[model samples]
Target chain A: MTEKAESPAARTSFFYLAIILVTLILSVIALSLGVTALQGGDASAGSYALVGFIGLALSAYMLLQTQRRPSRVTFEMPQVITTILCQKCGFKNIRDFQRGDYVFKEAEPCPKCNEKMMIASIYREVKEKEKERLS
Target chain B: MMLFVAFIFYGQRIQMYIMIREVESRLARLKFIRDEGRKMAISTIKEIGKPQEDPTERVDRFLEYIAIAPESMDPAGVVWKLEHVLDVRDIRFKDEVRLMAPEADEAQLNNLENTLEAALALNIIYKVIRHFYLLGKKTLSLYIIMQLQMVLPLIMREAEAFASALKAFATGQPIGDGAGALVAAKLMHGHEKRRIAQDIVVATVPLEGRTAHVLKSEGPGGNVGKPGDGIRRIIEETEGKIAAIVMVDAALKLEGEKPGDVAEGVGVAIGGPGIDQFKIEESVLKYKIPVNAVIVKEDIGDAVSPMRKEIFDAADTVIQRIKRLILERTKAGDSVIIAGIGNTIGIGQ
Candidate 1:
């Protein structure tokens, strides 16, 4: 019988739980200190306890937000394009490239001239603006 | 006094807990990445094992494999292995091209093979780096992620340049990186042009009172002709009479530097596997030659992608700088070699 490995999310959730526990304990200690300071008539000590309590509460809120959020990673893949031009009619067409396609190879016959269409260029679309600006 | 001490203790405890949670989150992210990398490696190996029925299909299969393959092996050993794989792929591509077009001449076939190899190599290197980069990101390795991020723009630019280079080779169009060759062609116009070696061209251009040997990679194919070989041969041919050797090439600009900025320096300015730079250095040392380097600066994003308008415009400035260096460093009636070092894809002579 093999034991299953814990996912990163699950592991992170456990850490978050631990953080919440610690924060709760700290908050309780701060509130109890504030109550004892008030009973002893020491306002300055009570204020310090209030500060500690607020700090822990803020920390707890941040930890809870992080725990509730999902981690996402995003990336973009660049596009590769092939351009074909007709030698006789000067007609041009752009299409996605197939593997093993080299430059200057003859493609299907030109529709207008009935002449061979050649792979004039095989280039990647590097610029995003070119797509919007040219089209 | 009691309440004050308790408050301080709780405050410290809360801070410690926060730090602990942060570290735990980072470690978890790293583990996630390691798991993802392992999965990708397994998938890639399985893809490589699939059988192809035809030569073209085999080429496609190999090309696709290289394009998506993850870099799971040790970094130190991967470079040599990648080079060998690229070499084998080049030979296979050449053989396939020959079979497809039996009528193509030796020169044409050689050009095609060189262009294809450079393009494929560029693509494979980019993919491999990206694979590791993704792994780093997944693993939540801040150091690895940061380092890869800094160089990612440069790598992407190189990939785009190589792609354009392939198009230039296919269509016989001049590309931007061929600024060196273009400058050489302009200076040596109407002069006796000679082919010193494979993919290297040389011609004599007369300056104000001296003669300079204008050397560049053979263009307008996807070629970064052997500038080191061209320089060494010219030095030998002139019997060490060469007064100075000036190299011009595109360089990656620092974050604050403007694109197309020209800077001058000493020694070889060529970039790559350091093979060509090493050759140039050896020859220069042997003859005790004064070497000058002129670099046109561009952002990493612009350097390897298709030549931008600014980079193209900077060529005039680069030419001026090269001429200025030669005039300043060497005297009249002396012989010099001006070598333009880069992939001469589109920009023509």
Candidate 2:
């Protein structure tokens, strides 16, 4: 199966970088060409300066647009409740706990056939602790 | 940010669904095997009754009728079925010697062997009976006993052998068959009143198709980043992921609390990287997938004495506690990731 991929961060970065590179290349070419034209008495020296100026303006616009968009976005993690369900009879049994707490406790048996239901782990978040510092 | 959060949530749910399916499949397979074993056990027994004649002769004949190599049974299912049978009261690796070859008389040795074997058979029967009441599980073995209410001597014989072995070992002499018989007889005398199956579960996790590094580092607390991120990376790298692991190395009681002793609610977590907790918790918070941990509690030293009922009872209590934990946290359709974290040398690493 083909998965559709879209990276806003990458796309935005790409556009911003392209504008800067184009401006830099244009400015260099304009300066060299202007100098050569002045020395050779070419009449297009004024147009070269204008082209360089426009390039500089475009570069500034790209930088401003990039800054306007937030560099990073924060997402609130979802609150999940881990509940137990019997695979044999599909009996639903909910647990109000995180992962490790169930290592040494007895859950109620499957109400249907009264089979010993092997607890598939409860993958619910209790509460979030602040992110850890590497140091 | 919303899209990113959605991606994480979606990934986590899919993973949880897959995990839940795996556990359900395993449980189903084991249950079927257990049912088959129960049938086999019943078929092997010619008749269930109390013998008044040469008890030894009857016991031997009975064992010959029911004795099937442990290997013949379902490999995975047998352990859970016979878990309560060969109760390893206390296994002392130090100064422990096996029976290499003894120069005892053939009749005496055979008698001793028969006695121990009888005891073992009794243990299986007793366990099968008690398991029903304790776990409320209905197997053919339990149903047979409940309908007839017959007391079998095989269980007593087994306990007597262990007791005799303990006495002989105390005097620092080679264990004789007569001493073994005495132990079996003594073990048979006790009317055990309480049950301990309430707390333990035979928990299994799949680590197949995952990278060695990710699998190796897949412990409770070693991940450096937020546990969610660490696990995500590990799972992504090792596509064949089933559970997130958290390991705890605590000093356990081989022989646990007194039979009626209520547990003092103790601390669950101690020193560790805390990464396993963080990532799993975050993932749960993000997507609602549950992570389960498998804990094995063993005694520190000879602190667990076979002679002491309290110590022996503690092992049962710990086992029960682990089972309870698993049951309480699991659901039918829910996927749970369990990490059996410990140095599994005795049980196999």
Candidate 3:
């Protein structure tokens, strides 16, 4: 079998970043050159100024395109929450889920009644993000 | 002029090449995810199971393990054949998990088995995608490549869901599929329990002046027990005298639908390779009993990943609906079977 590559997210290509960086650098150089040429009354000031504006526009477009695309699939772990219900007082306490937590497990004492609270439910909150178009 | 001529003559070829390139990139992503899933499984087995030596080889082998489906040429008794195949597969899987994680308890064994299963699922997806990707490249078939590319997004989503399930299973966290099992656990919490079927348990609970026999997959592990067989047993043991059967489970929701939305239908709401569903269907047919279904809606991703708050809260709504179904369909002192059909991971009975 052929060697599989690393996750693209982790290995964000320097190639694209390089292009953006070079464009911004060139834009700066062109703008400075245009300014120097105009201050010295150089004959090619208009062409220099035009080149600078085009480079700046190209860099801005690239930056926006990169930002607009959905971020790489990091696949971060979700935050699971545990809900503990006190049977006596009906007081509910919400907290971050611990490793050993399970549904219906008798857990910590309730602050309200000092009675042991039962872990009523343990689940993560999921945001249903729209999927990218595959059609 | 020569370049223009080439473009005109080979436009389709060029497009195919571009498409192949795109597929290659996604295939790489799939491979990475599959590898990560395997690594997580191995680490979890090591952490929880505490096996003696390095389990890298055994874990890799387990990931590649496959279940052969029984021959379907003879349609008669196919369900029983399939059930036998599944039973053997489950036994073999459990034995392998036990060997790998010798120190793990029964619940932990089930959870570890679930972790491996999730990893195996991811592995299969990666391999299948790669197979088609390579076949398309070799034959240079546009349709084959296009079909694979089209379904790749859904495939990726499912793969991601299974990947998340590894952690959920390893930690014994309840998943959305457990919504049904959670309901059963809630109903049978303080009631007397008895074994109804393989890895299934039942408790007799009195509800609204009716005798309700509520059952679910024996859990606090990740097993989805044979609820179908359990129902058949209930019917036989009770001599088909039950008034009605109410089945509760998590149903897959379409896009734009609310996750926790509850829907009512008529049937045994067990989702699997159809072994359980077939049994329930047969039992219902034989007894001529009306089977009602109450489902909690969730997306495919939500089904396997850790149970979401909405899906969790839907448990109560489902119970209430089940109560309503019982009250309206049957009278006081009547017997009813409430089957909570799902994986009972973190939800205990």
Candidate 4:
């Protein structure tokens, strides 16, 4: 089954948009109250205005920054099973499995020969080769 | 002040996260050990039991037998009889377990033949006397020879003891008094326990329409009816004294997990109705008997042939637990029930 991947930054941007929009409306309400209270005393009105400005600024910054960074980062062709063959003992190993599979994410030594293979590099080489052939 | 408070909360969150991570890792390791244990147990059971000989090798054995027995005689049949029947098979039987005495003169042999005839006439024939000619100062002593009279029963007794011990260890039950009657009582305790669970009566439902041949056909427990019914019968036969029946079956290990992993789960309803265990448990609850189950897990392939060491070791654990529980629950005359639930294939029920 295929799934459309959503980036973490995209997911965060939506979250911040909702927060900033609510914060902006709350600041407008605070400003209206401050103006109405200015008739009684200017000191309380000035403090309210300062607080509203800080709230709006913080919300805007949070919204923009969340959109800037990616929400999720995933490698290309994650579905492929990559195996690194060792020259010395002729060992073949599956380095990575599909999601919803076993959690063998740590570095593993070949049980038979105690030889280690860098699965990430093997995947990288395969990707490079595929790219070269495509070009 | 706000920053300090936030830092404190953050630290607390970090601690919680670390604790959860530790727990998850430990749970993973425990699961792995259980799975690996199951695999080893199965391999060991198969290894200890006699290995099946190849068919061609069996045929060669048959040929050897034919060479000794000739056309008319059956080796086991003839060899099981008088030691000196003057048949070609005696030469082959010599290599086997039954051996003729070197000292028997013609007169003693004649007397033995007469006695054998008399033993057969009185319906007091035994396999040992038929195979070997007994010769001694008195025929009475020879009749009670240890090999002929005691060894077979001893082997059977040992097998039963091993099975009983396995059950007791697996279930955490105490081995009862060493008295023969008590042993029999303990064995019956398991049967009686299964009887108390009311769901056992359901086993009789399927037998209402099925023929005897159909019921006796080769299948689970040599019964052709639905397995749920069989479980029900097991419960019924013991009378509503059993609380819950826990069938311990070996499940196969996943490729990732090491072999002999002990996987424990409420198995799906086998031989029909979704969870027959629930039915049995419900029946027990209806009768106010609290029901619970413990499955000594192994892989499916190795369930029948769990290794002797693993079985014995696990059985030890089972027996200890059972003994503690029974001692706690039982009084002087209280009937405690325990069952050695397994597919009694090679186990020699």
Measured by DockQ, the strongest candidate is 3
Considering just the first chain, candidate 2 attains a TM-score of: 0.38
**Candidate 1 Cα RMSD after full superposition onto the native fold (Å):** 10.8
Interface RMSD for all numbered candidates: 10.8, 23.1, 5.5, 21.6
Q: Per-residue lDDT for B165-185 in model 4, tens only?
A: 332222112221111111112
**Residue pairs with backbone atoms closer than 3 Å in model 1 (clashes):** B30-B139, B33-B138, B33-B139, B157-B304, B157-B305, B174-B346, B174-B347, B175-B346, B175-B347
> On residues A38-88, what C-alpha lDDT tens digit does candidate 1 reach at each position?
788887666757766775877778676756645542222234455789988
Reported per model, the fraction of native interface contacts reproduced equals: 0.04, 0.00, 0.59, 0.00
The CAPRI-style docking tier of model 3 reads: acceptable
lDDT of 1 at B57: 42
* Tens-digit per-residue lDDT, B1-349, candidate 1: 5545876878655554444344334344333333332232223222322223323443344345342222646676554555456456556766755654455454445545544454455546545665665576567555555555456555555554554344334433444454455556556655777999657888888886778998877654456766777888998899889899888888877766666677889989888666478678989899899998888876554544445545656667877887788788889999999888776654334
> What CA RMSD would you report for each candidate?
10.8, 30.4, 6.4, 32.1
Error in Å for residue B136 of model 2: 68
Best by TM-score: 3
Candidates 2 and 4, the one with greater TM-score: 4
Comparing 3 with 4 on TM-score, the higher-scoring candidate is: 3
Per-residue lDDT for A76-134 in model 4, tens only?
22222334445447676764432211111223576767776333211111122233342
lDDT of the structure predicted as candidate 4: 0.33
Per-candidate clash tally = 9, 42, 0, 50
